[model samples]
Target: MIPAEDRAEAGRPPARVRHRRVFYVPGYDPRSPRTYFLLFSRELRKFAALHGITARMRAGKEDPATSWHVTADWPGGPVKTTVDCLSWHEIAVRDFAVPKWRVALLSLRVLWDAVWTGTVWRMLRLNWKFGIFSLYPWGMALLYALAALGLVAACLTLAGAVGLPRLAGLAPAALGLYGLLRLTEILDRRFFVWYLINDWIFTWRHRTRRDPEADARFESFARRVADAAEDPSLDEVLVIGHSSGSFVSISIVARARELMREVEGRPRLALMTVGGNTPIAVAGRQPSPARAAMQALVTDGGMLWVDYFAPQDVLNFPWLEPVAAFRLDLGGKPPRNPSVRSARFREIFSEERYAEMAYRFYELHFQFLRANDRHGEYEFYRFLAGPEPLESVTREPG
Candidate 1:
């Protein structure tokens, strides 16, 4: 009905897409981003059916094992996968009752993958630039030499104590050993912090650089999820963050918004933090620094932030309120009374509503990558689909 130029001027890109639901998952490894694809592929397939869009997911160029796939009616022929519904079913069953020895072996593989793919990847990417300093190599060499010296000195001290009349002389050697252990812990934390900052910088660079194709893909995914609802207006996009993933999502969302001018009328965004450690992203030794940039993005972007805390989750900050800060609890259980609001900034009042889904909480951070049906239901599926949409926006709260 419109002229060609007018129609073209209507938009830089078309608003509608082939699919109605699109989901993106974060990598389970704090240092690497492969786990997200492994867990969410099936759900992505289900979501594709809501709309007539074909989906195809593959590994990032860097990591392949943790990648996934989803499609509808695409030009490419269907992908051949060793994974199928039945395979996942058996894997799930075995994992539920996995033998101790097998689990131990699996844990070792996971550790190896994490160290090699996650840690080593960062080292190679030099994304953080921690070890890239002019003096960093020399400093590290010196530090290692000092550690060796300390080890030898303590051994000598122990040998000297062997001939002492009493065991009192051994105290110094024991103290030295204890000090060495403490120093290791301190170094570990520092190295982790250094790596985090570098990753953050890498992510930030991408956010600012502007990627139209990637943003279009995300917008397509968002619109798909929005269209799946009986009422598109009530379609709420909920982002659930686990462990270090909180950082990735928050950063992505913020970056997405900064690029909003490039794409107009994007979907409204809300966030739920489950066992999140986002603070560590900008966090230094201090409690909380001013991240007005991040805070402003969420605030202006119309984000309804709901943070879930399990008291038992030791990896995240316990006392900080999510709307304002972070909290650590045993699955971060919400109050029984649904009437009680979760926090000042949080829209969802109580955690009781999500209680049955509590097993998804990761007090044990590493459990995130482990295949579990509970996680499939509580964490991933819940986002893709939920109970029937309210007939009206004002429908009674359950």
Candidate 2:
């Protein structure tokens, strides 16, 4: 038999109790928190079985006030994890389903802003820098144009069917345009592009307008985070932000830190941003309140901030450093930047599955939250329920 000290450390029991509280903030999604609970439950079971670990996740009542608890029985000991999904879906739903005219106006406004602020040029530059043309949002504009053309062609076809010889000349155009638009819409939802543009507008308004309801919700979320941080039973408090939620999470955490100064004992706080699109939210607004909040979080040394990006995900800027890209001014010497790690979705899914979803932008963006087919350092379930701490787990990407 091998000597005790020579034995594998993985077989040894953990030195400290494992209790973590996680706050998950979703992106510009209109789904309820129940969606996340269901996703977690499904993914946790699959990952646990694959890793040969005894893990069980039971979702509590579908209420924003309550937490979903997960338990994992590992070689070291049992780990208790409580996750709270801070959902802003209500806001998203209100903004995304506007009338067709409003969508057109918003799309026009987005284009105007892109031109006025050189956002279009910046996007082109990014495409060249990354050597990936998909980084440009031109596909969204093309989809919009095709959708409008399809609607017009449908109207023209109906007119032609009613024996209008004048419109007969447009018949061939109608057939080709309608068929192409339908196929494109089938691949990527037609409204997604408009919804994304509207989300950016909403961010701009939230920063500029300072709406009372939005401010109230922001305060409420920050208070919830502060409550979690102050809980003595928790060893770690992690705030997870995905996509648009990345910028919102930054603001919430900055506000939470402000409120935490009043609390006597706060747990170790950590921030994890996956497939983040923060640069878009803060773009064209230098010296803005949103930028100030982001700067505060980046410079705050007490919290451990880790951001994960996948090169294949075209929605998020993989090479943009939040601090340098934003031109954040931290007083005196700058603190270490957030540990930005690269995650590989190609490794997470099978070759067949990856190839099937190669062009699905949203699916690739969300790969950060799914169950991984290959064992990697960035397993979503393991980060939420495993024995290891998030800080250590995210130190290096596999």
Candidate 3:
């Protein structure tokens, strides 16, 4: 049932005003030690205006203590709603136009790990190849382990020696331990450097920083949404998951479904997983908790589940028969001289229906939140649901 507030303004035709409160979940820890590329409600406001959808967007930091809310009017008037961003991590993970962003983050993370690992190996290699222990693997292992233990001992001895009258004696002992610990930390940093430069550290940091007991934490947020949308008539509480947040989205939906079941007006939900990372999460021996949770949502809740992928966004998984596949040119419009922009998207989007919907408004994953659209097409943001006739809207300043 439409809200009485919305019903009061329902007379407009071409502008079917309805509330679609979008929750933009940042891909990883929205914030980290380094610079964070933020996604703002203002961007959403712009898209809402273009679509004639009025929206008030609220953004939140990665801090679990905060909340995000948005209410807006569009396509004419008086559509109101609040979006909870902190709680929408799951929806962000599950639905969106492009899955590649998540993939890119994960892939870059893996590559970064590989780089750091390579660095450590190189540092260790020098000793293994030409240092005093070069000839004997077994001997080197024994010596290194012993030396590591000695380093620890020396530090303790140094601390004990610190208050003693012999400062000179303490210096030698402290030096050995300090050098070893410093070396270890340097090697660790070396291992992580690749990710640091590329901005992929955000993913690792968020994952590592998340609590060991994450369920209660996630369940708390899910309950809040369930409580707020308690009125049974709120259509299907559809959840949209995008990029890495897909990991969180699946978990919440499953938990929310269970929690709401006891309520008389439990919501029927549709889990839309866009540019997701389910496959990535499940690629190894045992599926990650996030992947397992996603599967549970589908099996237990009987939720309407759909997944979207874009081939051009090298970051998506190679899952066959995805619910939808979008064809976007991450490469700027196929050379203007050859009418590349017109030809490329048409060629790629023509063969498949899901791809067509997915590609309707193609924005490169990285460029989605950016204001500057170098290729003239907002791409992803412009076609959130798909492309619409924009010629008329473009003529009028919206």
Best model per TM-score? 2
Write one digit per residue (lDDT tens) for candidate 1, span 176-252: 65676456447746443223323333233223333344334445433433342222333333444555445444544
**Each candidate: RMSD to true structure?**
16.2, 7.0, 15.6
Report residue 71 deviation for candidate 1 (angstroms): 8.0
lDDT of 3 by residue, 1-398 (tens): 11112211211111221332333334443243122212544465555655565555444456423344445443344444334454323322232222433533554455455344442233233223221211122243235458866766665666667674444455666567567645643653433222222223333332333333445656775776566434554333445456665656766666665676445544334444555434333322332455345445433313344444444443333242211111112233211100001112323233453343453322333332432212233233332222221221122211
| TM-score, per-candidate, Cα-based | 0.39, 0.81, 0.46
Model 1: lDDT of residue 124: 26
**Clash tally, candidates in order:** 25, 0, 32
How does model 1 fare in lDDT? 0.36
Q: Which candidate achieves the best lDDT against the true structure?
A: 2
Please give the lDDT score at residue 86 for candidate 1. Answer: 7
The parts of candidate 1 lying over 4 Å away from their true place are 1-36, 39-150, 157-240, 262-265, 281-290, 322-363, 366-378, 385-398
| lDDT by candidate, in order shown | 0.36, 0.71, 0.39
Q: Mark the regions of model 3 whose C-alpha exceeds 4 Å error after superposition.
A: 1-24, 30-38, 52-66, 87-213, 262-268, 300-302, 318-363, 367-398
